[model samples]
Target: MRNFWGLMRAYWFSSSWKEAWTLTVVIALLTALSSKAGVWFAEASGELINSIAFFHDAANTTPLTSLLENAAFLVGLVVIKDAGITGSRTYISATLHRRWRAWLDNRFNEALLDANHSHFHAQHGAGTPAPDNIDQRVQESIKDMTGGAIGLAMGVMAVATSLYFVGQKLISSSTEVAGLEFLGSYGSAVLAFVAVAVYVPLNTWIAVKLGGMLEQLSIRMQRAEGSYRGELTTLLRRSFHVAASRGEDVQKAMHERLYVDIDQTWGRHNIVSASYASFERVYNFVGARIVAYGPGLIPFVHNRIDLKGYITGAELVNALISQCSWFIHVMPAIATLRANSKRVIEVAVAIENVQKPDEFYRRTGRSEFRRTSQNPVFGLTIQNLELAHEGHDTTPFLAIDQLRFRRGEWIFLRGESGCGKTSLLKAINGLWPYGRGTIVLPEGVKSFYAAQDVRLPQVSLKEQVCLPDAPKDHSDARVAAALHKAGLGEFIEHLGDVTRQGKGWDQQLSGGQKQKLVVARILLQQPGLLFLDEASAALDPEGKIAFHQAIKDNCPNATVVSIMHEATPPRSASGTEFYDSVVTIADGTVIKKPLQPPLPAEITEILNRPAMRQPTRSPAMEEGWRRIARLRLKQK
Candidate 1:
């Protein structure tokens, strides 16, 4: 309940709430006026009938024409009132619902971005769980709840007011002298009381239970979609051969889960809907009986003022009609209110967790030791760095003991497949959890981190290169130049006109093309430090050579520390190579010896050189021979 109030307060704080509330009040007024108008017409018609009956009993008098004239005016007024009410309610409800949905969307987006970065990654990391489907929940479920809350509140208030009016009118008339008034309303008070008591409790219980079901079904639906989408994404990333070997089984299981969930959800929805309908019918029936018996309790049989003088038949008929309409249409509205309340609570709790202040800033040593400083010589320095998983008190996962990457020097992190190479890249980029360390970065130097699987947005090939915020202006000529440097010149030309012809950058490009596009983005940004995680893996050897040359030509002073799996190394310029230092790790430990650098020419030229073509044994076959030589030397 408290959570529901907080979620609602989000709307109260927004600029739209003032207008929404004004519209709500207007609609409520319209409903009240329209309802009263309906009763007014019925009352006038009944009085006309009584006046005619009185004249017939007198046997020598003409009918009272005023009652008949009043009936015509009342009917016309009701028609006008009803039309206005319908228009006002429809417009107000729609305006408020859309406005509420928009506000909720903005809030959800804020929460998603401000959430703990490490926690987001850990829960949604590679092959662990899919993040795409949570987006559906954020976009759809939250939107429904926010919009429904407004509609539900308005509906409950309207119905409650109607019931209150009926109770007041009936009780007043029921207190009259004995006879028809006493007999008719004697049982009505007790029946109406029992109906209200029984119906409200049942409605509340069923609404709460159904709300719980919807919550579970919402989560299950997201999971099923995530599983299917994740499998498809995996297959698209890996080669056909590699994907077929392992991914087929995972996809099949995910498909099965999706079907099972759909089946269960359908059954649950049917049961809840049927239960709601049954109770609604009973509630409406009781309301009809109360309204019909109401007039009998008005003492229509007074001696001087006969039955027609005390109460008119039209009031009874009109009350029954109005009460029935209100009772029948209002149950779903109540149930929706209950459901939205629960949803609001869930969102409130999530927001609270995301907003909690960090404890890292409170520690004493943290302030002095972990402050970011400028280093003139080395591009970056990590002092006594210790890393740990977010939201856990477990032991440190990895530690980097006082490492430095000198300016204008390249370093490589080579290791087995799953040895935290990517995690290290993330930490260096300040995208991970806080650790006990001091990181010194070069003054006024910018850095960019490019991941292995580059995110290809839905736009055409050109806009994807710019990203997040659109560039001031997009030039086809500049785009072509970047593409040419990255060995994608032919592909870009084939795409035609390139501006109007393509969607943006993402929709029209393949994986290799997108990788080229990312490199184009890097060139455009031109940060001082380029952190590449297999950024060049998609290109062929010649393409890789072209890309590296282009990087050197475009961003000459920039330092590149990349994760590479190639046997050959990059070349040098003016007798000094670009990669001055190599940091290679095998089985979690650094290899001390320096590797034989690439020959001072293109890798293709180096491989084709006559000296390189000299007969060489396969390294795997020579391992036994090398072991024997080592043993012989040891003996000496």
Candidate 2:
């Protein structure tokens, strides 16, 4: 009950909570007033019936006339009151449901961004899906949780109202007789009161158990859907090798488990429904028998007293009506209230998990540096660095003993897949899980990371190249230069206006074009320390060489660290040495190698032409008969 109340209180702090509260208050008033009217009519009818039965010895007339008149009047009033209540309840309930759902979606969207920053990739358990795909939970689980809580609350309220009226009517007529008739009716009312104590707890327990089963079933349903969709793609693509190697029999067996889990959960729900149905049936039966027939039974037992001493048939009917009135008056409201309450709890739990952990890392305010600092010496240094997950101790994902990138240096990290190459890059950029280490990025140092697959938004060609907020005028010229350097000059030239249907960046760009656009974006960014993860793989050999030269031209003093399968040209005598230090990894161990010139055999073959060692023409120049060789020969 305390948890349920807490859930309701949480909604008060949400965006649309004030409107929800106003609607709730309106629903509550209509419910209370309608309920009061029913109770009053029942009490008035009981009084009129008692008068007729008591005056039977003193020229008593027919009691049917009074009973019919009161019944008709009460019935008419109930019709009008219920109409208003129903309309008001529908409008309010619909508003509350929609607003609450919208609030949950907003929270989930916020969690996606927040959790991504906090390194929540593996936060969901192994069998569970990623946290960002929690859309199903937000849409479905929250609805069920809220519905269950509301139903439980409204059920309690209805039961309370029914018992209150029945209890008063029974106690008032308890002294009417000394026979078994009185005992039969009064004893049943006592039993009904005791049953309320016993069955309410039992039903509450059943509901909670059923709710757990439903939540589990919902998760299984999602897993099955994802599996089915994945398998369908594999089947269409004729990727049967994976299935054949695992044995198609095993795949079918795996699917059967999901089906069985959902089946078993639905089976348990039947037991819950049966338990509730049985309790309601018994409560209604006993209340009617005790309130309607118990008082009339006493008239036959005590012959000395008039029908007044006991209760007339009309009074007995009114008492029964009062006892059963809550079924109409209170049940629906309590049900809705319980359902809303549970949804509120689920939202609160998700929000709390994402919002906490403020003590860990908060971005501190500092003035931005305009240029890269050169004060830090040109030597790599690493003090202490360690990587450990929250609950594990033995093994770690990344173990950076001590490492750093010196200013104006080119460092190459080469390693096998999953040998922590990507993880190391993430750690350097502060994207991985937090660890105990102090990374003093020199005062004006800026870092840029290009992941394996470039991420491009579905925007115009210029926007994709320059990012959304970049200046439109500057983007056009810079994008052209970057594309030309990367050998994507023809592609960009054809995609002139990104807004036109066939010419739009998103409409015409391929995977390779998108990769080139990312390089263009970075060229424009010109960060101090550029971390490239196979960034130039989309380009040809000549394009790759030009791309490297363009980086040196754009950010002359910046340090570059790259993960590459191909090596750049070795240190030259006249030209600048592109990469001074090369760190290679073969078996998870870093090997520092000297940047030596080409082998003797290769140099002997290239001695025929001096231009072979150092090309005079620009890399972007096309090959033809009227080349630099022809021009140099004529000058000689």
Candidate 3:
């Protein structure tokens, strides 16, 4: 209960606190007005009904003409009140919902994408497994988190208003006994007190008891949904791979198992929900009415309240009961909130601050060069650095006793596949923290690491090139030059164009083309420290050579560390001694040297392009690009 309330009201303490409070107050006022309106309606309509019932009676001093006029005016006024107040309240509620959701999304996104790369760490860090189906949690649960709580709050206020007015009417005007007859006599009774002490408690107890079971089932249902959705999304993302393997049968079986979980979860939820509906909601409502009309059974009470008083009084009782009785209308919402609360909060908490270090974490090694009076270290320096996987720190796979690379050095990392080369790079980049030893990096250095498999966003070509920075901020000429230099000149003409018709970069680009795109990114970023963990392994032989040459040409001053597998040692295309040192890590040993370049061989593989169909260009369009190319060549 504490967690649930905290999650709901947390938005009020956020940066948008003023707005939150203001909207809440407005909603409260509207609820109070609506509650008071219900009482007025009950009283006025009761009198109206009495007047109409005995219209032609002689004892009825009230004329039909006056009565008709009052009825017309009262009904019209009530409608206008509803239109004015209810409409405003609804719109405000929707606005608050949207703003709250937007704020949550912004907050979550900012925390994940912070300078610390909290998102990455949240998924891979040593601790409880990361939250699953984050998008589903955000979409499904967030709606009711704020909206339902606000509604529940307003419902409380409305009930209070109703109780005060309706109870006052019965107490002050009737022959007491709360307007009910008992043992042929009447005595004073506190209708509000009785309802709060007896009726509300019973109703709430029943609701909570039944809804408790439903809450658990609701949690399971939501989990199943999130898991199912998450898997479907993953399969769709790797749809090409799945299709290439012709593993539809396997995929179907996997999806079927996941779907069965959903089906079973739904069945469990429905069982509890059905019980809740029959007992708590339907029976409770009916039983309450039976108890309520005991007053109406009395001659005097019946004459006074009639059916109208019963209804209006109910609005007050219902205002409070609505909080507990809410299951009737939004049981699933409450369940979803309870279930997804952990999921959504897990991400928020993890992203907001670093998780408290657990037993698995043992990295007291990495040390940054803090800026002091004098300039900090100029480049990266590792001392007794060791690397291991997060959970398997017992088996240290690689160790670097001492290695130093100064500014403007192109370092090659050569090793066999799975020789912990990538893990070493990750440790250097502050990613792996399982082993021991200090790795001091240059202070305030712009860094970019193109991992072996980097997932690019579905964005414009220019945006893709200028990622981790605003694409709009970069000039088309500089971006175009970078693209052309990386041998992606074919895409330069439409550099501004994004993927179309649902075909994203994933579907459009071949492996080699995608690697060239990475080269374009390195050119654009020109980071002070760059780490390429086999970033060019997908490219052909010529493409690989050209990749190195392009980097040397563009980002000449930056320190580069390229990971090269044993099958493909680092090569300098220009034959001008670009690589400063080749460090090979193999069988728990490190070899550092600079070997002479190998003789030119019969290399035949050319650049591999994507399968995307080229845009049909008119003769004029072809000539226009040709002219541009000629002009650039002439100017150079």
Candidate 4:
């Protein structure tokens, strides 16, 4: 129940709760009105049958005018119920469902990007044993749960109203039944109600017992579909690698395997559902009709009840039986709702786990990390630092007793491929919290961390270059200036986007140009501290050198840390624009080797550059602008 409320209380108690409740109340009123209309329509139609029988028996006594009135009344009721009340109820219910889904989606999206990077951890086995397959839970399961709950509410309302109508019929037919005269007074209504009550319970019991494992089966089916969907997305995301490596056969085999699992789960769920569904449409459909109408016909056949009484009794009884059979009709839907509800609750639990602070950073955890600030002279300070991966525990991967960099120094982390250079850098950046350490960053400054892969989100080129900084914050001139500084003058037109016509971003830029794009991002955002984990490893040596020079020119004051898993850190012949130090890690030991003579001229020269550097309008940049102008004119 707590788990159930975890998924419920969030929305029911949220800011939109009032509006949700308002729509719900409107829907409920319309539903009651609609159900009442059904009862009236039944009553109206039954009386017409009575009127027709009267005319047949005594043509003189029954008026043709009265018969026409009854027919007109039925037509008016159908119009009121079908066209007005039912239509309003549908629109209101759909509105409520849409609002509920939107609220839940926002909640999940926020949890997926929690403060501690637990979203990243959740991808691995940090909080849950398997990947949550959260996209399926959010997209498919949410829809089923809300839609099913509303459907169940409608069924319940129908049943409740029908029982009331049935009670009125029973009261009218209180006298002794023809064949059950021994039972005396109240035999007709009392006995029929008793028989129906007993039969419906028995039917419901059979359905529940047969569908016991359906919740688990539904969960399995959901997970199976999620797996297949995740695998399909993975195949698309890595299609470039697959095509390059010619791994189509391998990808095909994996997809087929996932599809096979889906088929196996689907077969199991269907087999159970088939037996379950048969209760409603096949068994109850025929049985309920017989039970309601068959016995009522007996009295008419015996001439104990007139045709008028028989028709009215049959109408009420049929309505009652159909309402009672709702349980049998809804057994399959109930299982699906429960399954979807359970899956949603599990996701709620996972999000709860993710929203908590990292286990290492919790106040009650085993380790403690103290962070302070250092001066430009002191650079970055670290002491008693140890780095390790989250799931791997033992001795730390790398240990640092003391390390410091001057304010404007460039450094490289050099070590073997599997060593902890990248891990150590991440710890300093706060994206990694699996280590125990004290990292004194430069006082009051924003820091940046670039991942190993180039991040080109499917957005405008300006947005890509101004990433980590909104395009709204910088004007077009400033953005173009940043691009010019990074040597991407031709890419200026793609500032809004180049992904139109027959060009894709992957097609528009080469491998080296993509690295330059990251450099452009660095120039634009201009963080006081920068950590690069193979951010430029894809570039050639000359390109790498140029990337360094661009940063030195644009962000000379920033503290730079780059990972170099290759051999020794390269130093230029001038020694003015290269790594100031190299931190090497091996065998869980730390070594900082200061590279070359102390540098001052390069720093002075960079400091002397213009306060607002202007981008020289090269011919490529001018032509790019001209092209954009022509496109805008055409748009006008």
Candidate 5:
């Protein structure tokens, strides 16, 4: 219950709260006005009937002109009431819907993507497992929350207005008849209160039970749908691999299982829906008649209120309007309120659960390391770092007592498969938190991680290459040059064409081409620190060497950390001496070794090359070299 309110408060106090509240208030006011108009219309209709009957019984006593005037006014009220209701509903669905969804999407993104608090993509075996059906939760469940919340609010307002106006009319107009004093003035209101007191608890119980079942069904449906969609995505992305392995049968079997699960869950859902429909139909039909006629019948059975008399028209109109009021204003509101509340509550609880650190620790039974920021310093530092997969206390995956890398150093990190190489990269990048460690890097240093499997958005190639930064920041010439250096010169002409026709780049490019694109992006951005996790695994040996040389030549000042399974020896003297150190990780520990400097002969060859003397090194290195030269001059 506390969590539910917390979720509500989070959304209600969000940046768009003022706009959301204004819209809600407008909707509520319109609902109240419409309800009042409807009740006034009903009362005017009864009065008009009584007036016409009086004129018919004694034509000289009541004027026909007055009856006509009342009829005209009632008709106008009906039109105005309907128009206002329609306008309110339309505005809520259109304008308010967009506003609320925009706010929710942004908030969800912040909670899911924030570097400090996000557990949305935490690994399954790590801190806290991510929630299932996140796509559905963000898209469908948010829609349900907004729509249900507004509907429930408007419904309650309409019901309250109807009850006050209708109860007042019945209490003031009813009278004693046939010596039955209890069935006198206010009898209709008394009977309505009694009937409602009996009906609300009974219907509320059934509605609550049905709502719980529906919530479960909604979750099951999303799971089945998400599973099927995930399979389809995999099939599309790995079509070549599937066909090569003849795994089509296995894929088909999986599809069949997902469909069967969907069918079974939907079958149960249909049964629950049908049961609710049956109960609602029967209850409304019987309940409306009893509440409408029970008071009128008592007067008639006691030989007081007579049909075919002057009072008959008013009495009959009263009963009919009373029944319509319950049907139109009360029953549907209660029903929708129940179902929508259930859905909204479920989604709200999920959002709250995902955002809480305590929940994550309780679920995984693991303590999470707190992320901290410190003053800027040169290079990188790590002290007593220890990392293990969540829920495991066995041998740690990667452990280091102390390590440091100086500024502008090129380091190669080598390890076999499943050697915690990428895991360490993630830990350094602040993506993994299920570890104990202190890693201090230069404050506010821009860093980029190029993963093995590159993800490209469904945009033009120009946008894809210059991502995480606006395309306007880089000229077309620079983008083309970067692509050419990465060996994608052929794609230069197709830059304007959307990748995969705006479907996704995954289907358009081969694995090797994707790797080159990632490298191309890294060269384009030129961050201060670059971590490459097998970014060249898909390329041939020659291609890998060429790309490595390009990184060294293009971004000389950038501190490069490459994680590779197979190390390719550099061909040129300049390339061979590029890396300052090599680090090997084995059996959960690291061994670092400094590289031997280039020989005098190799240095002479590099010096002879005009392109190598362009001074691509950082200013810090230039200053250090100038100091060395000055010392040599003084000695001479």
Candidate 6:
């Protein structure tokens, strides 16, 4: 219940509260008006039937003009009531749905995309597995929540209106019966209340149990479906390796497990659905009959009315049944609303939990960055940092007592796989918070990180290079020159074409080409601090040298910290001797050493046999080299 109210307050008390409340009130008014129209129409129907009966019984005295007028009025009332319901339902529902969806999407994005919040999600697990299908949660869950809320609200209003108007009528028309003076006029309302009092407790118990079961089943089924889809997508991504290794049998077994999971979950859901449906049918049948028969039974038992009055009593019974039927209709809607509300609140709680750590930091007045002094010579300073994975109390992954990199120092970080090279980098960037650390970085320093796998947006090539900002921020000439230096000059012609619509960079470019594009991004942005984690591992040896040389030439003053599998010592006379330090991490410790210049023999061999040392280059590559030379000369 607490969680449910929290979810409600999240939206109802959001920034759009005024608009949301206005729409809600308008919808309620429309619902009330429609309910009143329904009651008026029912009364008109009863009066029309009674008048017809009167005219038939006394043909000489009855007026035909009065019958025609009643008929016309009934037809007009039906049309107007239906039109109001349709218009109000359509407009109010659409507006409220749009508003709720927009607000939820914004809040979820703000939470999930925060730097600390993102790290938390990446490190820790939500109590129940976090929702894998965020798009579905944002789109489908919000749709269900908003639509079900409106439906439940309108249903409650219908019941309230029916009871108020119908109960008043029943109580107003009174009569004495059999000298006991029993309250005959209030019989229907009293019977309806008694029936509800008897039925609601049992029905509510069953509905609550079944609704909880169904909600759990639904969550499991959705998770299974998402897993199956993810498996298929992974298969497509690794099709080549799977086919090469003849992994068809293994993949088939994995797919079968996913299918079995979905099947069992759905089977359980169907059982609960069947049980609830049967119970609903029985409850409605028994409750409606009890309310319908109560009005006629009273007068018949007491002998209070003649044959004509008994027939009139039957008409009144039918009228009461017609008005009170909303009780029966709203039962299933309440159950559905409960289940959907649970699903929505589960997602909301997950997002809130992930963001709590960041909230704590903000409340304690702790900023993400810790700066020692203004404009420090060192771009990064790490002191007594110990890093570990979340939920683990074992030895730390990488521990550094003291480390600092001055501005314009080109440093190569090398470590074996799973030796905490990448983890250390993440800790330095304030992305890993599972351990004790104080990292003091220069304030207002611009930084860029390129991971092993580059993820470009589905936008034009020009825009992708200038990502997280507009392409117009950089001059066309500078963008083209950077591309040329990064060996992507050939793609300059197709820069305007969107990298989507089946023409994504992953499909259109080779692995080496993609890495070059990442390099192009670095060259274009020219941040003061750059961290490259296996950024050039996909390229050939010559290509790697060329990109490193380009980075050195273009951004000489930037601090470069690169993580690689093996350290590549620079040649002596190639102007690639800028690397100042080499840091190697192993056994949860770091060792830093100054870079040594290449041996005299290595420089002499490279100069004597250039063709034997260097890989063959295509015309585009030659043009790229020439462009790099021109850029270097212009820089000088």
lDDT winner among the candidates?
A: 4
Candidate 5 local lDDT, residue 253: 96
For lDDT, candidate 2 versus 5, the one ahead is: 5
lDDT of each: 0.58, 0.53, 0.68, 0.73, 0.67, 0.69
Question: lDDT by residue for model 4 over 1-636, one digit each (tens)?
Answer: 127656655676788889878887787778777766766776787778877767656554656877888889989999999889988888888888788888877777787766666566555445247346778887788888878777777678778766776667556675566769987766667656866777778887888876566767877888888888888877766778999999999999988998898898888888887777775566665554666666567666777777666666666666677777786677777778888888777766655555544552342232345678866566888889877655444466778898887778888888788788777876786655566789898887778887667646677888878887788988898889888877899878767874856666655676678778888888888888888888778877777777888888889888898885567565554655477887878898988878755435544443335741337767776556545545554576
lDDT of 2 at 423: 57
Candidates ranked, most accurate by TM-score first: 4, 3, 6, 5, 1, 2
Q: When superposed on Cα atoms, how far off is each prediction in RMSD?
A: 7.9, 9.7, 11.7, 12.2, 8.6, 8.3
* Candidate 3 lDDT, 337-449, residue by residue in tens: 56667667766765544533222243332322221221234588888876665554256778778887778888888877788888788777767656767777777778889
Candidate 1 residue runs with Cα over 4 Å from true position: 15-17, 38-78, 114-132, 160-253, 290-348, 355-371, 375-377, 388-397, 473-481, 489-507, 567-578, 587-636
Tens-digit lDDT string for candidate 6 (147-178): 76766666677667656755555455434444
Output the better candidate (5/6) by TM-score: 6
Q: Write the per-residue lDDT of candidate 5 for residues 1-636, one digit (tens) a residue.
A: 224445445555777789878876777777667766766776666666766666667554546777888788878877777776757666765677678767776776666666544544332322433555566666766676566555555666666766666566556655554444665655544554565656656666676677667667766776788788878877887889899999999989989999998999999988977787787776666655554456556565665545322133233334334433343333333444343334445444455564555345435533444444454446777777877765645456789887777767888888778888888888888655456778777667678899888767678888888987788999989999999998888888877778555556666888899988887898899887889888888888787888788888898777878887676334443446667888888999998889655445544554446653556768776556545545554576
Q: What's each prediction's TM-score?
A: 0.74, 0.61, 0.83, 0.84, 0.80, 0.82
**What's the true lDDT of residue 56 in model 4?**
51
- The full ranking of all candidates by lDDT, starting with the best, is 4, 6, 3, 5, 1, 2
The local distance difference test score of model 1 is 0.58
Q: What is the Å distance of residue 178 in model 6 from its true position?
A: 5.8
lDDT of 3: 0.68
Model 2 regions more than 4 Å off: 1-8, 13-20, 37-79, 119-133, 151-257, 267-382, 386-402, 406-410, 434-436, 442-447, 453-514, 520-529, 535-559, 567-581, 586-636
Each model's backbone clash number: 9, 16, 1, 0, 0, 0
lDDT of 6: 0.69
